[model samples]
Target: MIMRQAWLSSQVLSRVEPNGQAASVWRFFAGALFPIQLGSRGVRRIKNIAYGPEGRKHLLDIYLPKGPATAPMPVLLHVHGGGWIVGSKHQQAQPLIQYMASQGWLVIDINYRLAPWNRMPVMIQDVIRAVAWTKANITSYNGDPDFVALTGGSAGGHLVALAALASNVDGLRPELGDADCTVDACIPVYGLYDLLDQNQAMEVGVGEIRSFMTRFVMPKSYSEDAALWEKISPINHISPSAPPMLILHGQHDSLADLESAKAFAESLSRISKNKVTFVDLPGQQHAYDCAYSPPAPEHARAVHRFLESVRKDKQR
Candidate 1:
């Protein structure tokens, strides 16, 4: 009973607004139990550099290794997710990004325009533009432009997935003019695969989710633009040409249903010629990486292994 209660409390407390009584209560206890760490000995943080069409929101943080590398390091592009409305580069997966940096990998944590102001494809375009910027400029940071990997939770997962699969779609970033946005590998944690909800798998908070998407994120309703909805969904764009993907979804995720992840993995396995790995973690919840706990570090190590394995494959 204590375990169940703690688990429930952890999930509820994570969502509480900052500075509120509930959040204060949570921080008072959680602050000591699992202290957050965003830096390591060999990692260097370079903050708030504008990556593109230089608006306030069009920015990213680059984490580099302080130690000299024999050759250019691999790159990992992290996209933050907050239901398409909220979240930032600094708030999500700081430990994982720092760990990657410590391991001699260049990590780019990006911020994209949110909904209600920027609208749909703009968020997608912003991330793609970040990729273009990375490919062109990451060499200066001792990163190999050709070995780019993508990772994020929730909305970030969705964006990175589309960033890899749907890069060829129109209106993403016309200004780049052949700025290759193709990622070599992708790791989407607890991502929503089918935004159209064609299978009606999103039984939890269906109404609010649909209303928010149609009103803010989408230029038109699914009924009005079925083709467009189909195109943006990552699952629909699955092909043999897609980059290697490691899809991680929590089996007990309260936000993104596990069904979507299973379906996404099945689709990729069936169609994509590249490698596909899906891990259904038991007793885990959405955005668990927001804090650095047991499984968070474990998963981060797994991701590093996967990235290194991909690097080895390409080298051969």
Candidate 2:
């Protein structure tokens, strides 16, 4: 009964907007469930470290494992998803980050510039900058610079996939200086692989594609130059030199179509020299791993196994 009450209180507190009503409710439950620490213990957090000159938008949070530093641990850089419009490093992937840190890995959750204001390649550039920063400075935090892995969901998934497949492309790293921007493995969860296909498949005379293009995707329409859409799509960049990837998608992801993710994984498995594993979660939604959902722990275990496999292969 007490646990149920606490859960209800948390739900209420999360939705209550600032005004008099929320304040009254918060005061009433202040002593009951005010301080909530859902993250795992024994994980040291270094918050709000700048990765680039873009101020807060370029800041990141690092999670280090507990105990003495014996050797450098492998790194997992997490990016959050909000349709390239809204999201923060602190919100999404807390459960996954805490779990990974508890198991002795240096985790980095980063915030990148959003769309409608930053556009397509700029967001990718921010991710590249974050990787460059991690490579250069993660040693001080006891992270292995050479064995970095990338993961994220939705828009974040797209960025991570792009960063992995398009590593060290001259155009993406124009101002970030010369830094080894390669990742050992990538796990892009529920990402859109082909922007051109996505746009073209939209129903004719529908304003959704036009609205998405003008508002978030890019200022230029797909009609302007179809090749530009292909250029930005990760599916078009798959190569023999690309790193191992585990593409995870929900069976019913309404936002970023499940078929697209499956097709992307199939292409990667066929063309890329690296190992490609695809997991289709039954009855799962887009951000299923974000909270204490049923599949969160199971997915975390799967991720742990994948990371271990990648690490073993890297050592060989």
Give the Å error, residue 204, model 1.
4.2
**In model 1, where do residues sit more than 4 Å from their true spots?**
1-32, 199-208
lDDT of 2: 0.77
List, residue by residue over 60-135, the lDDT tens digit for candidate 2. Answer: 9999877887889999999999988889988987767888898899999999998777887788889988999999
Cα error, residue 118 of model 1, in Å, equals 1.1
Error of 2 at 26 (Å): 32
Per-residue C-alpha lDDT of model 1 across residues 1-316, encoded as one tens digit per residue: 4334334444443332222323234433443367576467788888888997757688899998896889998999999999888988889987689889888899999998998777778888888999999999999888899899999899999999999898868865547887798999999989888776665666566566668789888888979987777777888888999998888877678988788677788888888988898877657788866776535555666687778877888889
Alpha-carbon lDDT, every model = 0.79, 0.77
Q: Among all windows of ten consecutive residues in candidate 1, which has the lowest summed lDDT?
A: 14-23
Q: Give per-model TM-scores.
A: 0.87, 0.84
